[model samples]
Target: MVLLSCLQRCIQLLIWPVYILAYMGLWDSFYKRVFPYIMARFAPIYNQKVCKQKQELFSNLRKFAGPSGQLRLLEIGTGTGTNFQFYPPGCQLTCTDPNPNFRQFLLKSLSENPHVQLERSVVASGENLHEVPDGAVDVVVCTLVLCSVTNVSKVLKEVLRVLRLGGAFYFLEHVAADQSSWTYFWQKVCDPAWKCFGDGCSLSRETQKELEKTNFSELNLRRIHVAPRWSPTSPHIIGYAVK
Candidate 1:
């Protein structure tokens, strides 16, 4: 199994340049035109195995948000608003994404899921979080976002900073695999090509490790797998931590 995995990875690495070079010209167009359509179609199927855990996170958020019945939920990298369906009632959502292209797609999802009250939508990168105010939000929900940032620790500190005391950071992100595994090796090898097409996503990012470095009061993270069989990006961490 190890031998076969290494062989497959080596072959993939050899061809990666060809794969990436082909997309270099058309990549922007592909992201603007095709990616949203693909995401809208793919999100529901992708959410199937994962929604249960996600719902649990929302449930906790609801409790934290309390009697005014409004959770100040800030979702950084709110891609195409794929998570709109999962947001619980009374969420005053503040959505941000680095990609300006996703705004239209996000609006469409917002219209469909009217339960999520859109407080504001900003074109902002998670690394800086300049649009958000310090200690202003009740929950910082970051799903599948940590891997792509310019600096994970900077983004995390920002997550911690924006959150009010007792507020939480909800995360569901794919991280680097065990160092001994073929997946780890392949992730490192394929990362450059993957990031180019994946909108800055890092296949080998250990998001849980970055989260641990934060001065959060509590963290409860667990590893899990999800499918459609995207290797090296399928192993994920899902949990919440209170500030």
Candidate 2:
């Protein structure tokens, strides 16, 4: 028993570095190409389930956004620019991602959509957003990105800094399981493996809690389960917030 315990600890100790490297080399490439393809094919179905929620979000946004209906929107992890189709017309969209391959694809997609002015940069969450000015952006959108960032608090702070007062932060994310038993089991069993292959996505992260810690005001949050054909998990949190 003692030998087995020692072996387990040793193996666990070595997992993180191996996980990080594998994430950069293998999973990044796979996600850049494959995730977009999967999302593009299924976007119609996915959009249908979330239409009501999106309507509520847009309703609230329209009230704050004023008559021009033109807003400066920033998307943190604009993977292959799949979400661009959802943005209201007259949005000046700026997208950033660390993956160069994904950025190229995102730019190409942006060109096809003439309404959006594309700015591509190799930016990762928790890093400085020097290109975007403080209090300049009207809206910030993050979907399924908090799970992958290196430091959630830092990224949230940067997001808050960029948005003007009364500006909103829109998000749709998968969070830590609310049920402790299921959360513990997944955390114990899958987190290490998931961190390796899922690009630092933590199955146990409570994104709502993290958002609450930020400076954003009048936060309206909703939680929903997203049944994606590709993802094994059915319960995901989909909601929006205001800055």
Please give each candidate's TM-score.
Answer: 0.85, 0.76
Instruction: For each of the candidates, give the backbone clash count.
Output: 0, 0
Which predicted model would earn the best lDDT?
1
* lDDT score at residue 236, model 2, on the 0-100 scale: 64
Candidate 2 residue lDDT tens string, 1-243? 464456545656767666565567865666556555554556557667777766666554445463466677888887767676667766777777765556556766787777666544546554567788898778888877788788888888888898888788888777766554544444545666666556567777877888888777777777666664234344566666677
> Model 1, 65: alpha-carbon shift in Å?
0.8
lDDT of 1 by residue, 60-155 (tens): 667668347678999998978878888886589999887777778898999999998999998898888877889989988898788878898988
Off by over 4 Å in 2: 1-60, 66-69, 119-122, 228-232
Q: What are the clashing pairs of model 2? A: none
Q: Rate the local accuracy (lDDT) of all candidates.
A: 0.81, 0.68
